[model samples]
Target chain A: MKVAVVKYNAGNVQSVIYALQRLGVNPLHTEDQQEIRTADKVIFPGQGEASSAMDYLRSKGLDQVLTSLTQPFLGICIGLQLMCRHSEEGDTDCLGIFDLEVKRFKVHQHGFKVPHMGWNRLETDNSQLFQAVENPFMYYVHSYYAEVGIETTGITDYILPFSGALQKDNYYAVQAHPEKSSDAGQTILTNFLNI
Target chain B: MLTKRIIPCLDIKNGRTVKGINFVSLVDAGDPVEQAAIYSDAGADELVFLDITATLENRKTLVELVRKVASKINIPFTVGGGISQKEHVSELLNAGADKVSVNSAAVRDPQLIDRLAASFGSQCIVVAIDSRYIEGHDIVHTHGGSRPTELETMAWAQEVERRGAGEILLTSMDHDGTKKGFACDLTRKMSTTLTIPVIASGGGGSAAHFEEVFNGGKADAALAASIFHFHEVDIMDLKKELQAANIPMRI
Candidate 1:
């Protein structure tokens, strides 16, 4: 399978490469429009500030290229935040693939941390992603979460039932890091590949 | 609820796993690549590999080791020891490290933290503090815990957070290999003082010790090496015990 990992001014794409390699596929990491356009599966994984990333994307004109793709695309972490309508992170607008607004996790909530790091299970029932996957805990590392909306496929509760995974048409994005999330996370990747 | 993380740290020297008692008397433990895969499958939330290599050739060997380990494990991986610049971090990240920790260098040049956070984002930069409590005060020590810096522990943590560090890997030199327990007081102080996650490292002996650090220490995550490296404690069993104690663990 021809897989193209979207390359941008984001951190931690090496883990994505390792994730794909474990599944017996060596994906091509690229920023070229043609390489991303002609892939069987595209993964938009990132770990960085949304505002600066959006700036880089606009500079390289990847925003249009990402939104125009028809292939099965997966967005992870900052990638999901950037696919929304707008983010409160830096008052920056996103690609609008999913009509949802991203909000920061509220502070002063007793003793809980802000970034919501580490692993948590998915209280979701989507067969396409969770099929045959018994344990559903996946790694998450973010301060902002997309509010659960109509197209929400996976839901997790930190302060509220936020959208852990969103699916609309050909675009599917997850707030969790499947690459670093162990066995169940790999299963989610396999399910996406099968689709 | 966010689950508490149990991380097993590997002290690597020249591509081999080594262990020590209170930072001395190094002994060969096993293969790092094999140990990493075993820990991941056995339910370790994350893994840290501290490259204690001295020569440039050994540093190159560590990179190859990281590549081999990343290909097998499916969890968060953090690499530390002798990381001095943004270029070193980039090389490790390019070799499949999820996070790169800067210790002595960060203490020597505090501006290195800002530069790394700017280039790789705060989420990618981790400021590791090796601290020793003495004279009724906690003092920060760098240079493999042999030298003391003028900075205090709490003040350094505040500064690291202010300079945009994603996390702080706080290792208590006094309690590191003693395995009595984590420095609960220090861990709680740092966790409450900082907005970012605090990974409590050193002096993890038993499952109850993990409980003490997570509950009394208020640590976001607890890390240990000796107990995990010698099979004295299993990660799964430790999680079960912590879960039964009403601590939220990723089981």
Candidate 2:
């Protein structure tokens, strides 16, 4: 399958490429609109702060490019948050593909860490990504979370229940790094690839 | 209701996983890619690969190695070592690294933290602080614990967060690889003070050690190397213990 990974100043693009490679797909990494438009599946992956990452995306006109994608698009971590309507990190404006807001977890009474790093159980009734995995735990490393809404396909809890994964028609976004997660992580990618 | 995270870090040199006590007296741990898969099966929360070599040969081969691991495993993986620039961070992230850690670089140019966080987004930037107990002062270590900086660990952590660091991987040089236990006081002090989540690294000998880091240290996550590599403790078993301890864990 031909996969197009959106390239920006953020991290985790190569890991997504490698993940595709294991599935026998050496996906092309590019910021080119034509290439991205023509690809079978497009993945927008990132690791970085929100506002500036979005700034780069806008500077490159990638924000517009991403918003125009018709094929199935998967956004990872920051990519997923950027796909939302807004974010609390750096007061960033994001692509409004999914009608969700990315908000920071406020300091709570439990005294839990804010970033919510490491592996957490993924609870979802949607079998598309969780197929054969049976609610497996996936790797995560983030401070901000996408507020739960209609498009949420998976849910994980930190200080509260947040959008671990969101799917709205052709656009699919996951706050977790499927490239970094294990078999269940691969399954989500495989499912997205198939979609 | 988030499941507590258990991380296993592997120090990679020339693509091989190596372990040492007190960050010295190195020994072979295993193949990094293989170990990563093992950790995946055992339900590790995430894996961290620190390219400690900083060598031409190792650096050249490390990206490809990371690609190999990312392709096979479904979990998130973070890479550290020799990262300083935006392009380097871009390259590593593009190479399948979920996050790229900035240590010495962040210390040298604090703006580099802002640059990276602004470029990649704070979620992608990690400020790894190696710290030690100064008789009366809280100090941060640099150059992989070979040099000391005047920056206080807690103060630096606050600055790191302000500078746009998404998270802090706090490793205690005094406790690292000591296998005695985590620096509870240090971790608690930072955990309580910093707004961001802290991954406590160093001095984990058993499942109990993980508990100490989580409960006593109040760490969001606990990271270790040798204990996991040598099978001194199993990831699933450890998580089970943590779960039984009434600490929420992903089973």
Where model 2 places Cα greater than 4 Å from the true spot, the runs are A6-11, A30-39, A47-71, A82-95, A108-110, A127-129, B20-30, B82-88
Q: In candidate 1, which residue pairs clash?
A: none
lDDT of 1 by residue, B1-251 (tens): 78999999988888888774232122333678777877888899999998887467777888888888888888988899898878788888888888889989988899999999888877767889999998988999988899998989999999998898999999999999898999999999999878888999989999989999999999989998878767789899999999999998888
lDDT of each: 0.88, 0.81
Q: How much is the lDDT of residue A52 in candidate 1?
A: 90
Q: Lowest summed-lDDT stretch of 10 residues in model 1 chain A?
A: A107-116
Q: Best-fitting candidate, measured by DockQ? A: 1
Instruction: Point out the worst 10-residue segment of candidate 2 chain B by lDDT.
Output: B20-29
| Residue lDDT tens for model 2, B1-251 | 66768888988888877663221222333567767777777888778999998666666688788777876777776899978888778767666677788899889889999998766767678889998888888788889988899899888999999998977899988888789998888888888887777889989998888888888889888898888777788788998988999998877
**Best model per TM-score:** 1
Leading candidate by lDDT: 1
Model 1, A24-44: lDDT tens per residue?
999999998999999999999
DockQ score for model 1: 0.74
